[model samples]
Target: MTASQPTPASAATLDAQDPLRHFRERFHLPPGPDGQPSVYLCGNSLGLLPKAARAAVEQEFAAWERLGVEGHFHEPSMWMHYHETLAAATARLVGARPLEVVVMNNLTTNLHLLLISFYRPTVTRYKVLMEGGAFPSDQYALESQVRLHGLAPEEAIVELVPRPGEHTLRTEDIEAKIRELGASLATIILGGVNYYTGQAFDMAAITKAGHAVGATVGFDLAHAAGNLELHLHDWDVDFACWCTYKYLNSGPGGTSGVYVHERFANRPDLPRLAGWWGHDPSERFQMKKGFRPMPGAAGWQLSNAQIFPMAIHRAALALVDEAGGMAALRRKSEQLTGYLEALLRGLNLPATMLEIITPADPAARGCQLSVLVHRNGRALFEHLAQQGIIADWREPNVIRLAPVPLYNSFQDVQRAGAAIENWVAQAE
Candidate 1:
């Protein structure tokens, strides 16, 4: 082995010295076909369940059985204000003030709502800019939004494509595109992390560029919220949204989170599809005819709190806080992903057989490393599954492995590396 290549012993040593190693016990790792614990590396798609999640859900169930409608006003997590409980923790996760963030509707729903206000396209500036090959939902949302304005998508939607022979978009190219769109750009929204390529965009730079062009800026942080260190308020991001089922470990089809900068908190002039829940709580029970929005992100809510999912989400966020928040988690994540990258590089497989498509710079990505398998990709994925390695397979040819810092250990990375090496050996 080369001096740079990590060995099984080195992996074990790293795990032994890891400060966050104990967090692995907090999650219930999925069992492999062989019935042993699988090296679960699919957190980028769906995170593993936190052991505390069951009790959290049960608490809500008990509240319903005992309290009925009274539960909305009762102590110990009142359903009426349950969403408020998550505000501070959610804010910390994304680097925003508590008032700037709110736990709300699912990701796309929130995106559409935020668009109702932010994507106010006028005759002179009707264009929206996004990355090429964004997650399909984002593509559809932007296309539909353009149509809603009676504009042809082909003319109003500008997608930033990577240069020929490149697998990812460059920051310089993105900034230049913003400049090229200039006065015509009314809104700019991109994934905080590209779901397929696992590339974390330069959000701060993108936000600044968008504002310079007099455009509103936002992000779909579905792949980035718990995976990266964000500063939404400081970055002057106009708005953003993310789902909880991925790295947040809030169960399937969990609720989403939204961020609206404090500057818009009192802007009743902003267009939104108002609902009873968003009406000023001071007068909410008045059965009022006039709509008065609550200040800050909470005003964006269109429905009552999703109690059960919020319970699970509440438990999950506690674990993140106990694990020392994103700054500490990111320190471990960089090391863990760097180790995985080094191991893959050590394989020395031919480009025709395998290639790592995720960015090499750790700053440009989160925990996800998307492997582009050029030959028998599905077969390789199945091989890993049989070997007790759980990873995600994207259509056409990519396999995404995310070693989440909250629960994954260094040994898991070693096992994934060994499994890939075994596949190459068997293929030869």
Candidate 2:
């Protein structure tokens, strides 16, 4: 069907038939200006709170209250091994083996830890390649990492920018760049989904290209983990890290997830920053002088689990499992995003005023559709807020709207479209 053909009645019909529509009630949607639920299309920034999260957190509090320090070994849940509970579900979410995944520190911290082992640089093969506009945290981490190795950031870091006037990078161009960097490319790291443009890269192809050139391949899945159907193990990703607060619906500053390929599971030769918790549990209590790391991704843990955030994470992951995993979510995500695209395009706004910068091909993007506003951009964003359409506005020009399948309804998309249309009408 054409972008202009979907009407409000059609939207209702589609919502009614949606198998996942009932999942919307599982979240707590923020109220709009009218004191009703807002059209929340901003999961790309921060997801709505899962209704189950409160009970999960209370369970942890109750355990601590009853057992004190002994809660580390108590029933119902054990603080010492709490992170283990998340490993299997997280593995399934990202298509990795349970042994290869762990829930631990915040995103950038995990990235730095993974890079310590993966981004080993030699005098000749010292350059790192990444997408030009990576999220600021990734950029900062890379720059500081290179300096730690006593290499100049300018000489050791390479960023790939799109061709003239392009909003996103092409897969072929990325592959070409990898080949161009060749043996000098010590590591390849990019956001699995570009945060600004909402472009999802071909990770398997990218991993293959990086390995072909003797480079370690990793991804900052901060925007991709819960938003995309990932297969990190099949793709041979060396390492990856992501925050759980966005699409995963964990609370703000939720603990991050890490994946270290199983090949590194027992590679004690790999250099890493170790802590007491990461020590082999059998020997951990012995308080030995040497750090004998545990096998698998669990070995990357620097401290014991962050109980409060992890409680919420466990709760959020249950919702994903109950919804039949990412395969089911991805199917609905494509349709929900497509419906929003249709509604926006149907407005027929002048290109000078509004532009959908996100890739049109569903396979090349996530649920986010980045709208670039040329004139009165902030005004338009304010109009959206006033009209009860919650979206994310990037500095300068872009506004990002994500119709998350787990909670957002088709009616939310209709309201967003109407809000933008009203803004245009008033401006005219």
Candidate 3:
């Protein structure tokens, strides 16, 4: 059956029937200069603030004032066990066991830490395989890691790029490359979703292929953790990390999360750069000479949790759990994004003017749609901004629009589409 054309009335009907419609009220949308709520479609960059985040942080402040240092062991919320508060929800979001996940340092720091253990290199099998255009920080991290081990990145890092005339990598091509580099490949790490193209890779298949060749596999889930329905445990991913600022709805520069497969949780031989907080909690206060790592993902921690960021994390995660987890969010996301895509297609802009770089298949993408604006791209972006449409732009030409299922409404998508069509018409 042919899909109906997306219209304002149709969008309103969808919003009215949305089971998660009430969730829009849960976020504090950014306002324009006129004090009106702007059309926010950049959740893929930074999520809207949860209404409860301020209160949650203030609660921690009150506890700190009332108990001082004693807050570490006081009732209500103890600072000592703060990381534990968000573990279950975080685990649920990423599809992992509670023991496999932990909230800790920022994203790249955790990646370096994980690479220390998982990116084990030897004389014969030391090369790392990754996407060619991985987020710059990852490219830097992997290159520096190889150099840290006295290996030249040009010789040790194999980057996989899309085929000619392609915007994203093909899974079969990725697996084929893994097979080709079988013996020399020591590790495989990729973004769970490509930040620039918004393509969600086949992580499970990739992991299976990497394992077949004796390579440890991991993912940088900066865009996928909350946007995609991930199964890090089921996918048998060796290690993974993500920052909570984006789709996780934890504020800007929020606490990051790490996951280590259960298979390596108790491996005493696994080398890690640890600190006092990662020592066995029972003897953590003993000031012992030996550094016996704690079991599970917690063992990788280097310090105590950041309570303020975590308090915000707790509040944001509660909303995810309340909305019935990733399953419910994914359902709404598909429809809302599908509607937006249809609207963009209806614009019928010529290839020379604009093109959607993100994959057309819903299974291969999340909430983001990256539009490549060919003529006067930045000026067109500015035009949208002047219309109170808060979107993100990449250098060169890409305009990224993300319709967040948790807070963004169908009307917002409609407005964004109409605004884009109108802008293009005026520019011409």
Runs off by more than 4 Å, candidate 3: 1-4
Model 3 Cα lDDT, one tens digit per residue, 233-348: 99999999999999999989989999999998888689989888888999999898988988999999999889999999999999999999999999899888898999999998
For residues 1-428, could you state the per-residue lDDT of candidate 1 as single tens digits?
Answer: 11224888888888888888998998999899889899999999999999999999999999899999999999776999999999999999999999899998899999999998999999999999999899999999989988998999999999889999889999999999999989999999999999999999999999999999999999999999999999999999999999999999998999999999999999898999898898899999999698889999999998899998999999999999998999999999998999999999999988888999999999999999999999999999999999999999999999999999998988899999999999999999
- TM of each candidate vs. truth: 0.98, 0.98, 0.98
lDDT by residue for model 2 (332-359), tens: 8998899889888988888898999999
Superposed Cα deviation of residue 314, candidate 2 (Å): 0.4
- For each candidate in the order shown, give its overall lDDT on alpha carbons: 0.93, 0.93, 0.93
Which residue runs of candidate 1 sit more than 4 Å off their true CA positions?
Answer: 1-5
- List per-candidate RMSD values in Å: 1.7, 1.3, 1.3
| Residue 58 shift from truth in candidate 3, angstroms | 0.6
